[model samples]
Target chain A: MNFDKELDARGMNCPLPILKTKKSLTDMVSGQVLKVISTDCGSVKDMQAFADQTGNTLVSQTEENGEYIFFMQKK
Target chain B: MKKMAIIATKGTLDMAYPPFILASTAAALGYEVQVFFTFYGLQLLRKDLSSVMISPLANPAMPMPVPMPVMVQMLPGMESMATMMMKQKLKKHGVASLQELRDLCLEAEVKFVACQMTVDLFEFDKSEFIDNIEYGGAATFLGFAGDTDICLFV
Candidate 1:
């Protein structure tokens, strides 16, 4: 299924990017995906912890040209 | 997917803890959190003033039940004590300082907005704040708040 949204959280800091992603995900339907692009290095760990804590699915993640991209499915 | 906005305006010793703690905890809990600093809250972004921003004896918001004058006498050094206590509590709980939190937000990609009106009012140049802070107006903040699920005036 097509992801519901793309969130560009690049250049933001820890909790703000995660917070924005969380905010985006809340409005998403179950099973829908959100693509989060961030420049923050800590988002990798933070989002992992977030997915674990919230029961959301971290579908995929990768780094390209210095940006961190993550795909998450709403629980 | 819950979105929350916290407006941080007070920068007193007692006032600082709640916003940071609540915002960080909210982020930890998987909720999206945004903090908008305005007025005295902007002091938090000031490296020099941040550490010195304390409640004076005249502050009505001090927790003492006594009159302001008496409270000052009754609680000499309380601001420093409170600061120490907050630092200890944060360390014990693994919470970061305002500066560290700012770094963590940068690392975590958290969004931070500083009110432009306050900046102008205080004659603060953008360089006075940490790098990467987005400058915005009330309309911008309201736009974000409008779309968010929760909003708080702290």
Candidate 2:
């Protein structure tokens, strides 16, 4: 399925990238996907916790060219 | 299902901004946000407001070249300078001040709570605070936070 949004939070510290991602997701409907890119090492855990807490589905996570990408579907 | 509660206990100006900013943003995102101020954090609720509070110079958590006490002493008029810089920066970026943010939160029907124990400890009258403030204890705030989708301690 086509992702509904992309959030590039590279170089941002913890909480900020996750906070921004949450803000972006607020406007999306259920089943819509969001693609997140971040450079913070803490983001892996932060995003995972965020998805679990918000009941959003984390579709996939991958790393490429030194950046981390997370695919999530809004719940 | 958007709801959040932010517990604010720091008195320093820099530290104070996080809770207000986060709470305001949450409200803007349609979350039913509540900010509970306790301990030294009550300084933000003072009616006879002075300049924005400044962070303690000697925090262990602060990255160091200079110690905090020395930093505070070295920078005469730095508190005002930092406050002014923050004001300008927020305005430039469309972020709001604590007062303005508090107003917006009220306008949006977000909850603002002051810890009753803190008010008593600091010898402040409830009348001395801005309007729309609710009074409560830890239990009260905890009850609200229990069902919240987000909870932050700042």
Which predicted model would earn the best DockQ? 1
* Tens-digit per-residue lDDT, B1-154, candidate 1: 7777889898765576567756665665656778898998887666554464455445555454344574454476876765676566555644445666555445444566899999999898777677777888888888888988778898
> Compared with the true structure, what per-residue lDDT tens digits does model 2 show for residues B91-144?
565444567655655765778899999988978878878887899999999999
**lDDT at position B107, candidate 1:** 46
Q: Give the Cα error of residue B92 in candidate 1, in Å.
A: 6.2
**TM-score of candidate 2 relative to the true fold:** 0.59
Runs in model 1 lying further than 4 Å from the true structure = A1-53, A56-75, B48-52, B56-95
On a 0 to 1 DockQ scale, where is model 2?
0.07
All candidates: TM-score? 0.56, 0.59
True contacts kept of 1: 0.15
Model 2 docking grade? incorrect
* Predicted structure 2: lDDT: 0.75
lDDT of 1 at B17: 57
Whole-model Cα lDDT of every candidate shown, in order: 0.74, 0.75
